[model samples]
Target: MKAIFLVPKDYKLTGGMYMPINHYVDYFNRNGMIVDEIIELPYHKDNTCKGISERLHSKLSEEKYNIVGFTLNICYMMLRDFQLHKNSNCDCTCFLVDSMSLNMDSVIRNESIGKEYIEHILKFFLYELKEKYCLRNCNKIVYVSSVDKQYVLKRFNRDILGDVFVVPNGIDLPNEVSDKLVRNENDIPTLGTLTGFSQETLNNNLYPFLYSIFPQIIKEFPDIRFVIAGRGASVEVEEKLSHLDNVDYIGEVEDLHDFYDKVDIVVTTVKKDCGLINRVLEAWAYRRLNIGFSKNFAAFEYAENGVHYLSADNEGEFVSAVEYAIKYPDKARIIRDNGYDLVKNKYSWGKSGEVFLDIIENK
Candidate 1:
């Protein structure tokens, strides 16, 4: 079967949306399906609509695909384009990687500083409305995590939501990278976190929270230094975080396993998400104990609360979890073993391939 996957834009080696494309393309291609990931859509840096509609419409004519899927982002043009194809009786499946609703919050974030700049996005509600209407009309909608599924379900009834499917993102066991987890007597314990600076967190709302939380974590375990790995830092975020004692900003890593290898613990501090995150799965593959907020269900699904991962509902709880993690070394070991077992048994990419094929065939 020929399957075409639509992403918000092309893969940039960094960003939250790239994970599903990377994971899915490998799985589908290996199983005798043509998986085409369309990454040409523009973003803030390149804000040109520039014939994207014609390009996607032309792609459909090039080949007869049995299924077409979408990877949702802050923008819904990718989602709407897929619906246009599906409406033409072109068999399709959509992966709403984020919430089902229009991204008003993201629209606000992508807004520019100038008077006419932000005004354009602010006045484009009808375009967002069109996207929302198209999503409601699509044949099948796949969610990256159960949290996403529930949020969409709660907001819009099944009557409005068509064939809704919830399949959490899967992880490969990382057999090849297993040998690379070499521990060195490094300068610090290497507590690490990854994600581009999403505009949501780039604001001043989160830095004070980090300041309050990190200092307490250090007092409990002085040997550990934090690595904020990713390309999301703005001039403000960089200035605030870079000079701080041991917080290292390793911008846009080529191989994430290298970052994971040096870390004693992986942290996911995402404040919101309905989908499963790729960060937790990477940690699970390396047998690193994950500690982070409970709101991110992707991590919550793989790393059981207090079992395969440590969870914190609040700032105080996060500090306490870290303290307990350092004091009890066995805790990390046990969680690591359990995390790998869970990934191997339930969340492998091979399993994803088999299930996805079934979805296309059955639909």
Candidate 2:
């Protein structure tokens, strides 16, 4: 079988969005199928509907693929204008990393009502309509997590004629486990988190943990440190972190492994219940103790509260979880080992590829 993937022009090889497409291409080619990727024109204010339709039509006509896949960001507007799924001969599939409606909802509920808030409300309605059109017309819909799939289904409420499949995000394991998991005699016990510096994450995840939760943790363990790393931060966030004594804010990391190695415990501060929790998976893959909010863990139904990793729902629980990790190092090692085993067994790129291939071929 032959397949083609349409991705946004700005898509990078790293990060959550590109992982599935990268693995799918490798998996299909290794299994004697031809797979290719096309970088679509960047969407901008100047691009017209006619131009998008013409470009997409020309591209589709150039190949005779059995499956044509589209990343949701690049194709949502195109799908609305061209109805490419109805016009094309091959099976059209829409790949969603997360539900845009849910993301916009998070911004509305959390962010202050201003220009950005009003803008998100407008986008919420736009995405709701376009997503409905794509889900109804496409032959198949692929979601990165069950949480996203169920949210879309419940939000739309209309009968979707297409087949829906959940293909969870996968990670690439390191060749050798780093020795950083073993703490030094004089090193400070540190807790770390990595996330994008978007306004939504800053308000919902980072600020809450830093302002509300971290102060309490500091009161209990005055010597402990916190490390933060991600893409970018606003001036206000940077100033706040600068004032904090032991909090080290590394602006952006070149490699995530280096960041994981520096911290003793990984805390995922995301409270939103949508999208795959990549930080939890990365901590597990690196063989480090992970503590995350109970709500965010809903993204991974297979992960248990006490078995796979520690769960904290409130400030008090989070403080206690950190305290437990510090006081009982041996027990924390056991939990980390369990988490490592879970990632090795279930969350590999090869495994995710096989499931995606099965959906494409058998479904």
Candidate 3:
């Protein structure tokens, strides 16, 4: 079988989206399928729908591929292009890596943003409509997490549920988990997060909450330190966090494992219901105890509320969880061990490859 995968134009191979999609391509090829990846679609960053429409129609009209897969970002054009190739013998699948509906709902719920926010709602509504159409029409709908799959089922008609499938994101495990549970003979605990600095990241209200909650944590455990690392941190964000003595910002990092190795605990403060946060897997791989909201762990199968990692939903709970980890060293070590075992057995790239092969084969 021959297949083609469509990714958004200017899609950087850097973020969480790259690894999962790359795994899909490799899995298909290993199963005797010839897969061609096309990242030349002209819609995402460019709003010229008509030109993109014409080009996609022309491309699909020329040949019949056995399977045409679309990365979720370009779902708006998937169905329209597939319509042109309807005469050809091919199957269509959509891999929804992110939730457009949830994201739009997030923006719409905050009515204080004014007129432009309404425009964003209408625009996102069109994208949601297109996504629903593709989900209804496609041969298979692959979701990155079961949480998102359930979210779609609740929002859309019940009939499409059967077509939906879950193929969780995979990670490359580190060779060895850090054994340095204590901070250099001082025993001062350090917690950090490596996150992108964007409006979406800010919208989660995570960093700001941490900024507020950190002072509280340090009041009891005075030696604790919090490190924030990522790109796009505006001056405003930096100023807000600058007053705290225990807080530090390292900006963007080239070696994430080195960052992971240095920290005693990994903190994920995502406030939204979305795909599996990649940080959770990385934390487990590094044998670091992760403390964050339960929603961030919704994308994985092995994470139990108290088993794999410490769970916190709100600001108060998060502070308490960290305090508990700092006060009770034995419990923290247990969490780290459990998380390492879970990631080792179930979350590797090879295991994800087997899952994808079964998905494409209709198993």
Candidate 4:
């Protein structure tokens, strides 16, 4: 089957959207589908909305693709896609990717009021707003997480444009984690974290605080190292962290193999956002334990306190999780073994690919 994917030109910073699009493009191609990539630039130098509109207008059933897939995240992109779906003369199935419930979930609301508002607005929209417009436009809808799937199904009999499907984000796991005995030989208890925190999100937090604390961690486990992998660290984030002798800032790594190789544990000390951090999956794929902050992280089902992830609810808990991950080396290896298996079984791209292909083929 021929499939053409329409994705936005999201820079690598938007980790959630970026990785899933990349994964499907490559994965579907591998699994007997002829896949084509078409990106809608985000107001780049060469292209304005007019140019993108004209571009979308031109590429109809003219291509070899038998299927038309509009893969994007956020409400803003929906404006363009709604028109694209409205305009197409193609016979191809219109597949929509909305991994999370975008309509009713409040991005800004805290727990108590957020739930009250979320439940009301979510119920209302699944009945009113989304069902009337968005969900009705496609032949199939794909969500990257199960929370997203359950929220939509239990709330609305709203027939999503496509057959409603869930293909949770996947990992490309290695065959085997090295036995615990060999991990120390390579690198002992090194923890790594990826930060795309530009001036926008962390005006002055994440990296600065992390750098300061690393020295204390170094004092205790002098052999322990830290790898900082990401693209949008502010010039200030780069400048301050550069002086820290222990932190290794490897900028914009295309493939995660080397970064995952050098680390024993991974960290995601995020102060905000949820619905499956890509780095957590990366750690799982590599058979490494993860440590993440616990606020708004309720969306993840697998991130238990000690089993799959070591979570820290506050700064004290953060320090303690780090200390625990560093101290008990055997526990870390066991975490790696369990995590690797979990990802391979439940979250590998192969699993996602198999399910999604069946959805697309209507099998």
TM-score of each: 0.76, 0.90, 0.87, 0.68
Query: What TM-score does candidate 2 get on C-alpha atoms?
Result: 0.90
Q: Which residue pairs collide, candidate 3?
A: none
| Tens digit per residue, CA lDDT, model 3, 135-170 | 767767877788877888888864362477777777
Ranking by lDDT: 2, 3, 1, 4
Estimate the overall C-alpha local distance difference test score of candidate 1: 0.62
Measured on C-alpha atoms, candidate 2 has an lDDT of 0.76
lDDT of 2 by residue, 232-301 (tens): 7888878888898679998788987778878888888786666888888888888888897886778777
Off by over 4 Å in 2: 44-63, 67-70, 111-115, 179-188, 234-236
**Ranking 1 against 3 by TM-score, winner:** 3
Give the least accurate 10-residue stretch of model 3, judged by summed lDDT.
Answer: 81-90
Question: 99-136, model 4: which lDDT tens digit per residue?
Answer: 33432343324234545546655654543454334456
Per-residue lDDT of 1-363 in model 1, one digit per residue for the tens? 566665555654544556656766777777777676555455432435436555556766666665444554323554444345453535666666555343343335544576744654664454446435545766577766666566556656643446666666676566654422213322234678776676555442245445877777777667667877777577887887878876877776778776776677777765544457677877877777777777653424545687777787666787787666656666556776787778778887677667766777685
Could you give the C-alpha RMSD of every candidate to the true structure, in order shown?
Answer: 5.5, 2.7, 3.1, 6.4
Name the runs in model 1 displaced over 4 angstroms.
12-19, 29-32, 35-64, 72-89, 100-131, 158-161, 175-189, 204-209, 232-239, 298-303
Instruction: Give the candidate number with the greatest TM-score.
Output: 2
lDDT: worst 10-residue window of model 4: 73-82
| Model 1 lDDT, residue 171, Cα | 69
